[model samples]
Each structure stands twice: as C-alpha cells, then as structure tokens.
Target: MEQTTKNLVLASIGNIYEQSKSSSLNAGFFESADADLKLVSEYFGVTPNQALIVAMVFALNYKGDTVDIKDLTEFFECNPLKMLEYSDDFETLFNLGIFKKIKSTHRMKLSLANDQFIINQKITEAILLNRAMPVVEKERINDIIELIEELYKLGKQVDDKEMESFELFRHVSSMLDTNAHFPLVKKINEFEFTTTDTYLLLYLIWRTVNGNEATEVGRIAQGIFSSSSARINFVQDIINGDNRLISENLMEVVEAEFFDDTEVKLTANALTLIHEHGIKLFGKKKKSKDLIEPESITVKNLIFNEFEQKQLDFLYSTLSDENFIATQERLEKKGLPKGITVLLHGLPGTGKTETVFQLAKTTGRSILKVDISRSKSMWFGESEKIIKRIFTNYTEYTKNCDRTPILLFNEADAIISKRRDAGTSNTSQTENAMQNIILEELENFKGIFIATTNLSKNLDTAFERRFLFKIEFNKPSLAIKSQIWHDKLPILLQEECDQLASRYDFSGGQIDNIVRKAEIHEIIHGIGVNFDNLLEFCNTELLAKKHESNLGFSKK
Candidate 1:
C-alpha cells in the first residue's frame, strides 16, 4: 500500500502531538515512529530534525495555525531552551521559501523565537498532492526594480547585524548574477564594481525610485553599515569622492552650503541607466508654470539670415523624432553623450527664445523652460539642488511623453556664462557651483537641451565643449528683416517694407515690437497708419518715449 500524506503525518507530528507528553523529543522517539527519521530525511533531502520540524509546520498549516520555535516548548513538551536548537533549520527553511515568515507581536529585544513561520501555500498544496518539494526555492526576480529592492532589504539586515557585510555583498552579486536578464542588471554587470560598491549603488537606486526622501549622509551610513567605524569610513569615502559609486558617476552627495548638510542620491548617469529599463523615478516630476506644451505655443514665422537659416535647417532635421532617436542611439553606442545640446548665443533681440519655441513646435515635443530668475534662491545650496532637480525632473518627464521634450534655458546667460572663480564670494561661489553641476549634467545628458543666451562673449569654454550644436542667432540680415516686415505687416507695400527694414537694423524680435505698436494704433483708430507712422512706432519701440498714446498712428 502507498503511504499517503495523512498517514505520513499520523506517523510523524500527529503521533507526537496526540497523547504524548514526552519532555524530550530525542533520537529514540523519532527512530521508533512508523515513518522513522532516516526514511523521511533522505526522502525530503533535509536533516532528520528538519524533517521533524517540516512535518510539524505542515500539520500546523493544515489546521490554519502558525508555528514558531517558541511554541516548540509547549508542543513537544521540551525545555524552552531546547526549542532554540531549531533556529538554524527554521531560517534555512524560511530562506528556501518552503516556510513563509510572518510578523509576530513579540516584544523588542526578543530573539529569533519571535519569528513565526507558516508553510508556503504552494508547498502545502504540493504535499497534499503527494508531490515532493524542491530542494531550493527563492522569489524569481521579474525586473530590475524588484532585484534592487530585494538587495536593499538585505542591506538593511546588514545594518541590524542580522547578517554580515560580506554575506550581504555575496547575495548582491548572486542576485545580480542570477537576474542578469534585466537590462539594468546586464549593464551593471558589464562593469566590475566591487560587491560592496554594487550594493551601495543598488541602495541609492532603491531610495531614489522608492521615493524615500531622507538620504542624509548620517542616516544612510547608519542604515547601511553595521559598525560605527565602518559608517564613518563610508561617509568619509563619499565626502572624499573615493567611493566607486561617486567616482564612477553612479551616485552623488549633494551639499548644502548654508546649513553644511549633505544628502546622497543617484547621479544623472545612474538615473539614465535605471531609466533605460523603463522605471520612472517617482516624485521627480515637477508640476509648475515652467513646462510649456507644444500645443500651447503660438505659431511664429521666424526670419533668419542665410547662415543662421542653414544652421537652423540642419538642427530641425536632426531633432525630428525619428532622426533624434537614431542619432542618440548611435551616440550611446559610441559612449558619447546622447544629448543634442544647442547653444543659441547672440544679441538679446535676435529671436533666440522664439527659435526654441519653433523647434519644440516642429518636433512635436514639450518645453521644460527653465525660469532663470526662480532657479536661484536667496538661501544657500537651494539653487544647486533646484538645478539638479531640473535634470532629474526632465528625466522623469521623458517617460510621461511620447517624445522627449526640450529643456529650454531661454536667456540662459545667467546660468551658462563664464563661471566665477571658486570661493570668490557667497554669490560668486553659488554661481560657480551651479555652472559646475550644469557642466557635469551635460556630460551624460540624454535629451535635447537648448540654451538661449545673449552673453555671446562671456559664455564659458567648458559649456562650449558640452554643446553639440552652437548656432549663433545673428541679428536678421537686411533682406531677412525686410521679409519679416513684409510678413508682419502685409498691409505695407513691398517698397515700404524694404524702407522700414533698411532704415533700422531691427531683429525679428525688435520687428515684433513695432508690429505690436502698429496693432495698438489699428485697435484705437480703426485704420492702417501711413509709412511715416510705421517708422515712428519702430523708433519709439526701442526708446523710452510714451508710444501708446498716439493710439492708432505710428508717427506723423
């Protein structure tokens, strides 16, 4: 006759639990059972004692009750201290996923006895069907985020001293090796960071995507390192930039000058890497007036000179969604930054900002406009954080859009100009710090960035190297200005448009000012002013003269 699970349990845990007051469940008792220790141990591929504990938990789960080592004292009628002997086997079973660990309401400072265990539901079903349990079991990692989060939990255990650093690191390497199917896992494995460094990187990745806002240096050290000296050394390594995560551009320690505080976070490189796996780090997207949708932008006809037009024509073709993605992929393959950074540097009224608007409109993308004024804060270090966040938020916003948007720094002279000498003054230092971070972010930037700056002369050389397309917005040529005038005021005769364009070397933007004044005139007087009135509007548009009163007339 075949031995069923019911008979098996009867021969094992049930026999012991029923009418048996054995103070000691020793080798003699197990050997005397109908299904003895040796028979069960070899069958289950566990030690004799593990077989006994498994049978006990199986029977407990069948009854909808939990089992713990603490409960062993009463169940087996053995001494409570003797019950402690099963902890190693219990944990092994829990780790194997054969037994599920459940939270117990034990008081603090209690030992492993406080950990209650339940048989894995699947394992119990298999047992009921007379099927054998697998020798080893673990949760399968479905994606990079799950793998990172699992390692992160093990890292916290290292802090509790529940596990050693090397063991935690071992699990890190093992988890990565086992889950190398993930894109992020494959990328990280391509590099040879030490196991400890890999774990640290994973911890930061976990924090960033998990939205755990507290990344203070001290707090991180306390959570990741077990001993005081190790914590201090880890903190020092971060501060000194000696840590692999810092040196390799996977993580960063943001410093606050006013309060002398520090917080750690995943760097742009790390953010980009994780994003390649399609995980958008939460809470990084900023919702403010700064984001301009393409649909919201007014269609403006821009007139540039021959040279500027050529540059813009090439840029427009390269930034079309298909061309942009193909180029970025090729650049990434070559280990070059996959960013299409454009520096539109020229005079203030040269249509730099308007060009960005047109580019975004033509490319079918949004514009994350950087408001230069609000980007800086009176409080120290806040500006730098805001700058870093701009990049982070842009990274998140990429996932929210069908095509990545443009990060426009209109009138960016304030941010991209020649950085001041370090430590010159608080404001100067702040400026220098902001520029340095921008340069760094530009290093691995992965999207379209267009900075329109009027400071043609003082723009930093470092910034020059970072920008791929440095197109100058020279003031509109005489012919282009004439065309702009003809387009803006079709009411003007061609000769009159030429005369207006030739007399004043106005840019498209300056021409726009005159067009607005002409609009006001028509609004009040209900008729187009003569050519003299057009010149008058142009003249006062640049001067401080009270130009709105003449109402409909440009000038007499």
Candidate 2:
C-alpha cells in the first residue's frame, strides 16, 4: 500500500479508538468504536500488527503530545517491523512528525532509579525516518507531511472566533494565486489598508473561501462594519486596493507572480481588476454571474417607463420610511419577525423585477432573487429542502450582517397560487407542501420580501394580504417608450437614434437588444449609425418575439 494511504487508515483507526476510550462509560461508545475499527480494517485489510501500530500511535498523539515508537511498541506489545522492510509503511507517519517536530535530541540512557530506557520523541523518530529516505522520496514525504498538517488543522475544534480565523485561512489559501500574481502590496495604495479595509478584506477572504455568491460580498461587508463611516470606508477600500491585508504565507503557496521592483500602488483600475478577477483566482468553476442584487444594479441605465418609474418611486419611498427603518433596527436589535411581504404584479415586459431591484438599490439593501420555477422537484419533499436552503442562506447572510436582505420571489404565483379542486395525488401534495413552506417562510421572514408575478389573480388572497405594498406595473406609454429607447441607445447614435426609436414598438428588453446589435454593427461594419443595420436588428428582434408568441400559442 502507498505510505500516505496506510497512514490515513492508521489515523482513522486511532481516532475511532481514542473516541471510544473517551466515551468508554457510555454503553454504545465501545460498540461504535469497534464497528468503526472493523470498517477501517475491512477497508485496509492490513495485518494485525500494522493495525495495532496505527491504533497505538493515534491514541498517544490525539492531544498532539510526543510518543516514543519503542515505548509505543512495548505498550501495545506489538513487534516492531524492521526499519528497511517496512520503510514504506512508516514513511507518511514519519514525515508528518517531522513537520510537526519542534525539538529533538539523541539520547540512549536508562532511568536512574526505575531502570526505564529513554528515547527520542515521536516527532524525532519521524524526522529520522524522513532523513533516511532517498532524495526523491524525501520530497514526496514533505508533501505528505504538509497535507497531514493541513488536515489536522482543519479537524481541530474551533470556537466561533477560531472558526472565523480558519475561514480567513481558507480564503487566503484560495486567493493565494491572485494575491501572489497581483500582490496586494504592489496593487493596493498605501492609504487604503486602514482598520476598516482590513476587516472588510478579512470578511471578503472568508466569503471567497466559503464559496458564497459574489452578490453577497457587499452585504457581507455591510454586516462587518458597525457604523456608516466604517461601511463607507470599506467601500472606499474595495474601490481602491490600499494595503496587503492577505497573509504572506498564503501568497507563497499559490506561487503568485509579483510585479518586479515596481511600487505599483492600487488605483481604481486595480480595484476593478480585483472585483472582476479575484473571484476567478479562488479556483471555483465559473458559474453564470446571472444572480442580480439591488445595490449593484443602476436604474439610470435600465429602460423604466413613466408608470414603472412612478411605481418604483412609491416602493422606494415606502422602503425609505422611518417605520421601515425602525422595523429593520428592531429586527437587528432583537431578531427577525414574521409577516413582511411586498407583491409586485405586472404583465410580461413590464418593470416588476426592475422595480424590485430599484427598491433594493435605493434602500442600500441586498437582494436574493429566488426563481420559483427552478425550485420545483420530482421527489417528494425535495423541493421543500431546496426552497428552505434558499431562505436559510438569506437568513444566515442577513444575520451575519444584522441587516435585512431583500428576498425576491420571481414568478411566485406559480409556486404559491390558489389551490385547484381538492386532490390527494403526489403532484397535488407537492404543490400544497410547497405553498405551505412558502407561507411559513413568509410568516417568519422579518426582512423585506418582494414577490413578482405576471398573473396576480392566480396568487392566494392570504399571500396577497401579507404584502405591505401591492403595486401593479402597467405597459409603458409612447412618451415613456420614446424616452426608454433614447436612454438605452448610445449617445453617439443621435438623430438616427430618435428616428429608429420612433419606428419600433419595442419593450425595454427589445430596446436593449437593439442597442447591443447596433453597437456590434458599428464595430464590424465601421459605420457609426447605419440605418440598414439598425433596421435589420429591429426586424430580427420583432421576428424573434413573434416566433416566441406563435410558439406559446401553438403549445396552448
């Protein structure tokens, strides 16, 4: 067997046995330990002597104290394998001891009165074994040693504070590559790494390592800062890389390439780069960055018609109320309460979702948009767990910050619609279960909750009444549509833009598509505002929408 594999098996056995001894008084403890050991023995199929060696080592070293191998053999009454014959078996264990070794000395002597033989520490024995290995094996041994140490650290019992530290460690470890290549020392400006920035960076590091969504990054920052000034300061630091807040040790592991001899301080550009690339450096598989948050979005850029704007203004004003503020404060001071919900009903292509974003942005709050369609499941009770996880994540995030995060339920009517005629089949049961779960979640939710649905009539009246604000978003007027087109299109396309805007009966999304296509046309054809390209793009969009409408009709 590979030395590392052997050591791992031994360690597992040791841990199980130690756990057994610790809870020996308990009736099930020994039985549980015996079962675990039997499992380990079955897994490794090692000799009895090897099993005993492993068990003895684990028991003695559980507290990270030293143990002499010779003494270990005597204690367990197991014959010691010849150093040369069982070299591979002992290699991994020996190397771990070497890395953990603090001090060692060679001494062969008998106890003065007791006639006991003195020996070196377990760590010393491991080191001696490591040194005896070939040069190639020595490197492999070193790697195993480091791996063991890391696993040991990860398994250590941690308090809340220590947990935070461990999280920081993981974050730093993950960002080592990014930090090394784009070392914060070179990238961050001298003035930026203040106390507030340090805390924010620490929080960012934690979030980064824990695989939290990027949209939650700002919310995490807001939670860490106790005061407005601190929050502002953190934002400033994020907008400017001020100092080396990440650890140097972590930077080394990733072999990060540093800018040579260049005292390049963090500029706005550096901050932008960190925001864009730092997430990638964490080594997670790239997921779609489609999750939308409120503060991160800009309404000025979106195509909001007059009626949509009016509804947005009302919602924004409601969110800005002192009552809302007091409610939020109360939630933070005590804990989250139940029965806070908002319903935004609108037709397709209206600004229900956009308004939700605007409300969150205006209030300087985070938004977690839960897609109800995606939450549906085939298995009984599985959908409930998925829905619960979403709420749990939102709650945990808010609790961490002591701020209420806006929970956005998109297409909520589909999930929480009024019940059909009484039916007890699995599908009906699932639907009923989902509705109950959502209602329960809504009742318990203390923070801002916004539900957007196209078919408002389909929603349960009980659910509808829970919303503090029930707003309807209607289709935009021609005047508002003209403004949306003008705002959405680029400034360089001037007179031609007005003419193009006037022609199309386009929604906000269609207008956005037109602008994107126009940009591409301008870039490829070298024509700044070609009428032909604009018309072509518009026709394509109109045709696509028509095709979708026809498909929906056909399906119906």
The most accurate candidate by lDDT is: 1
Model 1 lDDT tens row, 313-405: 999999998899899889899988889999999888888888889889988888999887877877778789889888887876786678888
Q: How close is candidate 2 to the true structure, as a TM-score?
A: 0.48
Q: lDDT of each structure? A: 0.76, 0.52
Model 1: colliding residue pairs: 521-552, 533-555
TM-scores of all candidate predictions against the true structure: 0.62, 0.48
- Taking every candidate in turn, the Cα RMSD to the unseen true structure, in Å, is 8.4, 21.7
